[model samples]
Target: MTTKKLTWVSMLLAMCVLGANFKLLGSIALDSFPAFLGAMILGPVYGAFLGIAGHFVSALLAGFPQTLPIHIIIGFLMGICMFIFGLVRKKAMGDGIMVKAVSWLIAYIVSVPLNLLILYPVLHEVVFVLFVPLTIATLANLLISELVYAVLPSKIKNFGQSKVV
Candidate 1:
């Protein structure tokens, strides 16, 4: 990638790590804000990087309460979620409102099945416990990211469009 692109990614990565400090519950935190931002700005690949990296950082800080392996899988899932979030936004380009609504809805929608695929089997009884925080965090993360992106000046918002995001 170009140096400029690298710098933006690095900045977002740092933001992601910083966000990892704010814990909502267990390994869930506000880190995905930067991931979503990176998705919308730098592209899905970069967003995936941020998502995985952010989750790992959050998990690490939380002492991997759910185990490293679980967190690792979750990290990868988060990466894929970021990828789809960016992909949807990229595809639904013109209408900003629709882009935000559809992408956020789709991201949240996909997360359920992906999470349930493993979580339901592993924690069949208590799996429902995570749903609340997951929903809260997911909405907060995406909404905050979208709001920030929406408010950016047109020129600033165009920062990485040419490359992909």
Candidate 2:
């Protein structure tokens, strides 16, 4: 696909995934998978764009509440995290497993603080209990992103290869 098409596809996919995975204030959520997948398959810039688009959609859907600025900042940071994940993957340090593991690690490290201190505070309208859901959601997203990156495309590719064979 052309770059523009790829970007559009990635953004739309991210939005869909975010929409599907959204959780209010309870339970862990794995909303970052699409952006992570986009980062792995596409490039950092596209990943960032996809993340931003997804966040924007999610924020809009959630309704413009008091946390609009916080959402925007979180969205931008998420884009940066995805972009960095893409960059690390592009380095091709080892196999896909290692790349995804490290990328997930990086995302977790960055997201934990941002989610707990920044996003959650805005979300809960309080600061004390912010870490709970943020931690849960971030971990969930990390695991989900890693698994999706590790399995999805390869599964499809294997199925295609087997059919061809």
Q: Which predicted model would earn the best lDDT?
A: 1
| Model 1 lDDT on a 0 to 1 scale | 0.84
TM-score of each: 0.92, 0.71
lDDT of 1 at 57: 95
Top model by TM-score, which number?
1
**Per-model lDDT:** 0.84, 0.63
Enumerate residue pairs that collide in model 1. Answer: none
List model 1 lDDT by residue over 1-165, tens digit each.
Answer: 887789989999999989899999998899999999998887789999999999999999999988888888889889999999988877675746767778888788756556756767766765577788888888899888988887988775677677533
Please give, for residues 61-89, the per-residue lDDT of candidate 2 as tens digits: 65644367877787788788878877887
For model 1, what is the alpha-carbon lDDT of residue 119?
69
